[model samples]
Target: MTGMSRCPAHTERAQTSLPALGIALVLLTVVTGLGVSMADAAIAGAERTPDERRVAAAIADRLVSADGPLAARSNVLNRSRVDDFDQSALERSAPPATEYAVSVEVADTEIASSGAVHSGTQITRLVVVEARESRTLTPDLTTTDTVTLPRRSAQATVTIDPPAGTTIWTVRANDRVVLHNRSGLDGSYEVPLIPYETTELRFQRAGSIQPGNVTVSYDAPRSTKESLVVTVDA
Candidate 1:
């Protein structure tokens, strides 16, 4: 027998190894991409400090409180106070703001800030801004003994300048006696009224009362909802 050509088993083994090597390379590439992504997220998280967020939240909370400098009531900001808000006002209202770079804004307008803040943690609150305006009303008491106020007021200045023969002794507001005199009632008097109810001023007198005899001046608060934002950078 002349030299017979034999099939080599090593050649078959080499062909099988090629497929396994390709699969291993694909798995390595996938693992490397996941590692890179995790590392980037970790780096970004490390850059943000917890103090900034805490301070921002605290400032926003204090600003909307009832006792705050800019608030007339809880979550209601006074228009005059908001206009006067500044760095000193912020520090006075929120002491934590003094230590950090804090910025306060309302309706996208910067109202107060302790420091220049480009970017940082932020806290937002929905609030109402109130503006009070003084208005006077002198209703005709001849047609009816009751006079209803158009707007709600916390307090009012009641002026009783009755003409001769009109002996006014008592004044009732919303069925509640606000002013009473045994002999006679005259001059301007400050009366406290509830802001939630519509007030009807009633006069108890023996004679006819003319218009402009009783003048009531009260503050009418107008409110509009707005957004307040506080940013802190450490």
Candidate 2:
């Protein structure tokens, strides 16, 4: 060794005192923990702006209301409408959506968002989503010319397959003329009806008809409960 180099043990001891190193590391850990705790406390104490919370609540209320675009009844959302809901739909349904950053979700799936949201207020409401499912019914028209539907539907698919001698001239839904063919109605047709009341289809025919001659297919609404969440950032 040209310059009296220190041994490994001596070099290690000279680099730093064991007691001092231990104390420094312990103090560093304590300071870091304190800093983290203080940051958590500050964040917990910070609440969203009152206006943000109010707007969030309002948007949530409007989305679940009966007259809302996404809803079919009070707190009952239409699945078709919900699927079509977007930022434009949100702004149209709730005017406040245009002024603030708003996002709406159901069952954790985001349906509509107006703007970017980092952090703000959230309002949650319980709601039911109604989906229109196809259901078919073939009424027993062997003896009676009238048939009542079991469920209410907005429109029905009326399929006519009459025998050679039979001819259906007209069809009515509770006195409302749905189909009229002076020559003879011989094919399938879609008929619109009022969904608010029970429907009874009456057929006007000139020849004999039996069961399995007429069939009806309609969409019945099925509902499932879900949570509607609205978040607003201002």
Candidate 3:
């Protein structure tokens, strides 16, 4: 028996379908390429999250350190320097990677920023800021009978030893009377120091009493502590 011959019209239809098959293959390749690109972007974004967090933590730690550029003491920031901080300071303090943006906030208030911050990682730190004036008074009372304070102190604590058969009459700071008592006194007393150019403290006594073991103490202005937040975008 003779083998069945192929139909001429059917062969032409099969040949024409080859171009459609090729077009379908091209479309599949393009779709696959696009999907791969999207996947890579998502993976990169996920990887950057941890890296940005680490960078932000490191930067915040450095800023709050005693030896860092913006710190006066450990976890204490200089208010003037913090106010002056800007993009240039951020760049100088940050790592040498230019792919990230950084911003700083103290007590929920934005202080410094660099680059656009749409989305990224964040870190918060406890920091102290000395925005007010601070001073310490430790007079040279060891060598002298009287103590003088260099600055005008608002408050002072005086410690003294009363001599036998003597009564403490009055206390004077910078020649201005501050405390006066008729009874015999011994131990510590808190007194408000008068604001003067030179504040001097002396005890007035009766019955030939000599001052012994006297100390005057003054505390500096108080500092405030708050949260410091750092954000980084990659």
* Predicted structure with the largest TM-score when compared to the true one: 1
Candidate number that wins on TM-score, 1 or 3: 1
Candidate 1 local lDDT, 61-135, one digit each (tens): 899999988898899999999999999889988998878889999989999888789788889999999999998
- Whichever of 1 and 2 has more TM-score, that candidate is 1
Cα misplacement distance, residue 179 of candidate 3 (Å)? 25
User: Which residue pairs come into collision in candidate 1?
Assistant: none
lDDT of each: 0.87, 0.87, 0.75
Which is superior by lDDT, 2 or 3? 2
Tens-digit lDDT track of model 2 for 1-234: 835576876878977797798899999999999999999877764644778889999889888888988888889889989999998989988999899999899989999998898877899999999898888878777788997864548899999989998899999999899999988898899999788788999999988887788998888878788999999988
The TM-score between candidate 3 and the true structure equals 0.49
What is the lDDT for 165 in model 3?
A: 70
Off by over 4 Å in 2: 1-47, 65-67, 87-101, 114-119
Number of clashes in model 2? 0
* Decoy 2 TM-score against native: 0.66
